[model samples]
Target: MLAPKRSWIQQVVYLIGMYGQFLKVYVKTLVEYRADTLIAVIAGIVAQGSTLIFLTVIFNRIPTLAGWDFYELVFMFGLAATGRALNQTFFNAPFLLTGYIRNGRMDMMMVRPVGVLFQAIGYSQELNGVGQLITGFAIMGYSASHLDMAWTFLSVLYVGIALLCSAFIQFSILLTISVLTFWIQEVRSLIYPITWLYDFTRYPLQIFHPLLRGLLTYIIPYSLASFYPAAYLLRPEQYGWAVWGVPAAAMVIVMMAYFIWSQGLKRYSSVAG
Candidate 1:
């Protein structure tokens, strides 16, 4: 006899429960390895710390860069770090798709009842992102306190939503690049150059040349992940569009990524004979 099909809501609930189980096991493993977790956290802290030092040196020479004060720039840095950390923490498995495909692990996933992408996303979480999360939030809190802006509940909620949308944009981009592995079977070279674009988003968008600003705003939209959202919070009149635009862009990019992944999956071939 055939089994009954679940409704959409039921399926979503099932997936959430399954993901919870995955998290339980993942956390248990992390807890089992105290040294590894500590090292990963320290690495994240050091990485962000170096960026902070560089910013400090630049500010020491001048009061502001491109009309943005030191704390304002720090706020953007914190937003970027937080968004990147979220991507690393939850969606990092896409980076390993090349190996998974080459080793027939993807073939194994194909036979499972769960969706391939869901299983892949739940496969592992980056412990180092915990460190990044700490530093990012700490920096944001410190900078916010120093800034003259008022922080009400609504403002906090808006910032939280912006951060989630920023992370979504990044995850969509990474997943889109990873999907190329289905055809090329290796995407490290392509991914590196694209990821380098994110460096430009660490500073004020107004400072960059018009061409570079256009690239970040329209082509890759990395600025939506950091600069635009941060700017919307810091200077609402100047970047008011981001209030609607960031989430809209995230939805569009994620839809595009999913379509590409589906197409790539259809063309996927197994290495096994």
Candidate 2:
């Protein structure tokens, strides 16, 4: 006779436990490769640092960019960085999907009992993201000290929700790109240009031309992750509605990406075969 089927709750619990185990292995790997992990973290910090340097140089010349003060822009950058760190830390495995597809690893994953997407998501944990998280929070804290912002309980709660939504949006986009590999089998070229568009989100959307702003807001929606949330926190009266919209956009994008992934999985003809 067959074994009993797990309930949805039991399945979720099992996945969570499995994910925790994967995370422990990742931690162990990081510990074993201390220098490599440190270098990776430093590279992340330096990349963000370069942006900070650019911001400093630009702010020195001008009081504000598109009506946003230096601190305001920094706050937005920090928000973006934090969201990106969350994505890199938890959902970066999509970047490695090409290899999995090429090297017959996808075959192994397909034969496993777990959901493929869950396995893909938990495949890697990036230690480098820790550096981005450090800088993101530090910059946000420093900027908040300079800005005249209120830190009410509601405001803090909203910030947490916004960050989670932002990470979800980013992960959905990456997952969608990875899904394309299921069809075309090579999409690294497509991923970079698309993902690089997120840099536009580090500053105020008001500075960009109407067309670019529309692209960022609607098509890519990176601005929702960085600018809208920062704007809402900085000036709630002006951008209060975004608190609702961010989560809505995240949910929609994630559902859409998951649908595409499901379809792609069905269409997938394993490279091994």
Candidate 3:
């Protein structure tokens, strides 16, 4: 039988505890295979740098995108990078659900005392976060130097909170996509579209039409993962709304994601169970 549903705060604490345990195992596993880990880390950093460079090239040709200047765009990109990194580090393994199910790993997890979803997402160091950290901070620095902002202590704290919410959104979206494994049986085909959302993230919602942009900002809100945070970081005076909206939206999205994942879990059929 499944564990009884707990209070929201308890659920979060449980998940965090699971993540800590899994991260420890992940690090130990990587330490055993140090050479492969080093190679993978380096390759990941190079790939991240290439992506940032491509963004720079695009901005060089087009001065401003949807009224968002270059540095602002870069800031959004940085936020995107950081969010993606966190998602990959923590929740990306959910994408492996179908394969695990097909191969009987789901049965193994079911026998464990911890929650299945927690065990799945937090199973592995993501070995790649280090590289993403480097490239993401580099992108942030580039934007910080070019963009004008009064960085007070409060502002920095707000920005940090915004970034964390962005990461939460990123994790939620990936979980939704990955949960399809219960039906699709294979998800490699979906990776590109989910990753493409990162491209859409680098600009303001205004680049699209008013209706489309509005829908994106509210309904789907993937772009908001970065653009909203950048709005606060770049033009905090004009977009004071983010001071409230960012966390509120993140809370809503995370709740929605949790609900969806629970339904997906109910739908999952264990070959062994």
Residue pairs in clash, model 2: none
Give the per-residue lDDT of model 3 (tens digit) for 51-133: 66886798889887778877787787787777777666666665677777898888888777677777777663477675675
TM-score leaderboard ranking: 1, 2, 3
Quantify all predictions' global Cα lDDT against the true fold.
0.86, 0.87, 0.75
lDDT of 2 by residue, 1-273 (tens): 232499999988888999999999888888899998888778877988899899999989999898899999988999999988888888887788888888888888888888788888888677888778778878888888999999999988988888898888988887888889888968999888888888889888888899999999988888888889999999999998997988888899999999998999898777757
In candidate 2 the C-alpha lDDT for residue 233 amounts to 96
lDDT of 3 at 243: 86
Where does the lowest 10-residue lDDT sum fall in candidate 2? 1-10
Write model 1 residue lDDT over 61-172, tens digit each, in one string: 9999999999999999998898888877877777778878888899998878888888888985878787888788888888888898878897798888888887778877
How well does candidate 2 score on lDDT at residue 107? 87
Candidate 2 contains a number of clashing pairs equal to: 0
TM-score comparison, 2 vs 3, better candidate:
2
Candidates 1 and 2 compared: the better one by lDDT is 2
Return the TM-score for each candidate structure: 0.95, 0.95, 0.83
Best by TM-score: 1
Output the lDDT of residue 210, model 1: 99
- Misplaced by over 4 Å in model 3 are 1-18, 29-32, 55-63, 210-215
